[model samples]
Target: MHRIIFATGNEGKMKEIRMILKDLDCQVLSMKEAGIEADIVEDGTTFEENAIIKAKAIMELSGNIVLADDSGLEVDAMDKAPGVYSARFMGEDTSYDIKNNYILEQLKGLPEEKRSARFVSVIACAFPDGRIFTTRGVFEGFIGDKISGENGFGYDPIFWVPEFGCTSAELPPEVKNAVSHRGKALGSMKEKLKEML
Candidate 1:
């Protein structure tokens, strides 16, 4: 089977990526598992650019197919703040608990309609032959007044999915994966890979 390296260090994202790509005719390995460690700067002003940057950096180092994703929560109330900086919001080392609560506090007293938000994900793939492509996915929902759920990481606990009437974190892995931004992006990537594979 072909081996594809995914450039990411977050355990949460790794789990989701592995789950989503499990059926592919390829082995998905994280950067750590591939013994790759580099401080690739993601200075892109957009998610697509960041994902591409990461994928290219890892592909150059490993000379293999590489996939990378840049995803984040965009709260409309905050003018889509913490969009690309979702991981680094409130500082890179801050706990998600603190970050989640801080967002709730900032949007305190806001009406439900005013709390609309969405999760965005951009997946970039780099091939050894110098081909690169990108796909984007978005999950629309509201921001819960309080942090809740345990099934997800980052802003999942506060991302209200009205269709499910719960936060993204509360949904089962299978359900979340079916509807998540990253899931959608990966699904698109999977089709692309299938054609190439």
Candidate 2:
């Protein structure tokens, strides 16, 4: 089976990726699992650009198929203030509790409709032969007034799913994987990999 390195140190994301792509005929490994260590700078202004940057950077070092995803929460109320900077929103070291609370405080008085937000995931797969494939997935929802779920990471607890009448974090892993932004993106990427592999 071909070895594929996913460029991310976040275990939460790794779990989701592994679960979604488990049926693929390839070995999916994290950068650390593949013995890759580097400070890749994601200077792109958009999710797609950032994903490409990381994928290409890792592929250059490993000479293997590298996958990277840049995802974030875009809130319409905040005019997408933390779109590309979601990880660094309240500062890189700040906890998500603080970040989630801060967002809640910002939209305290606003109605649910005004708290519109969406999660975006852009996946980029870079081959050793200098070819790159990209896919995007977006999950639409409004922001909840409080952090409510424990099953998800990042901004998931605050992302309300209107269709489910709950937060994204509240959904089960199987359910979330079937409807999440990362799941959707990874699902699409899996098809591309099936053809390429």
Candidate 3:
């Protein structure tokens, strides 16, 4: 089977990507699976840039088609803060509980409408032939006053989807994968992947 290198160390992200592509003829392999390890510096100012930086680095090293993504929560009330900094909003080692609480405090006393936010995902697929395809997905919603649900990672607990009437964390894996920012981007890129594979 054709191998698609997914350049991420996060197992949660790797699992989600694999689940998304389970039906494809190709196989998605994590960095470890591919016997490649990288410590990429995600210093880009935007999601697309960071994704590209990561994708290119891995592709250059492995000489394979590599997919890399950078996603984050963009809160309108916070002037779109923590956009590219979502992973390290409260420092890299800080727990999500602390980070989530910090974000909640920033939007305290504000109504739901004022707490509008969105999760943005940018995916970069880099080929060894110096070719790249990039796609973006946005999940619109609001940030709740406190965390909820036991599912998902990062800001999922506080991300309230008005359409679902629940936080992303409250949704089942299948449901979340079908509607998440990463899911949308991966879905959009599915056909492209099929074509490329």
Candidate 4:
């Protein structure tokens, strides 16, 4: 099996990627598992740049193919805020709940139509030879009145999908995978992986 380092420590995301790529003859190992703790500076202004920064850092460290994703919620009403700074929205040390509450409070009194938003994911694949491939995906939805489910991470609970008739957190794993931003971005890379590898 081909082994690649996935530049993330989130177990949930790792699990989701693994499940999505289950049919492939590949293994996804985390940065920690690869015996490297390089602090990749993601000071980019865009998701694509941030993802490329992470993927390149990990690839250089491990000398293997590296895949990194930079994703976040883009609220239209908030002028697409918390875009690249999704993780550090409320503060560097703030928890997810705090971040969610902060957004909810900021969005108070906004109608459902005006609360439209989308999740954007950019995936960067960096090879040791300095080649980079990037793909982007977006899942359009709106912010719900309140946090609705407990199954997803990040801003999933507040992202309402009208077509799915629920928030991203309310959907099952398979269903979410089928329509998630990460899934769409990864799907874009599927053919590229086959052709390159």
lDDT computed for candidate 2: 0.95
Candidate 4, residues 1-197: lDDT per residue as tens digits?
77888899888898888877777667778887877788777899999999999999888878999999999999988899988999888786888778887888889999889999999999999988889999999999998878889779988998899998898999999889889999999878765777887
lDDT of 4 at 174: 89
Question: Which window of 10 residues has the lowest lDDT sum in candidate 3?
Answer: 188-197
What TM-score does prediction 1 earn?
Answer: 0.99
Q: Lowest-scoring 10 consecutive residues by lDDT in candidate 1? A: 145-154
With a 3 Å backbone cut-off (N, CA, C), the pairs that clash in candidate 3 are none
- Candidate 2 residues 174-196, lDDT tens each? 99999999999999999999999
What would the TM-scores of all predictions be?
A: 0.99, 0.99, 0.97, 0.97
Predicted structure 3: lDDT: 0.91
Better of 2 and 3 by lDDT: 2
Distance from true location, Cα of 185 in model 4, Å: 0.4
Model 4: residues with Cα > 4 Å off, grouped in runs: none
lDDT of 3 by residue, 26-104 (tens): 8789999999978999889899999999999999999888999999999999999889999988799999999999999
Where is model 2 more than 4 Å wrong at Cα? none
Output the TM-score of candidate 2.
Answer: 0.99
Q: How far is each candidate from the true structure, as Cα RMSD in Å?
A: 0.6, 0.6, 0.9, 1.0
Q: Which pairs, if any, clash in model 2? A: none
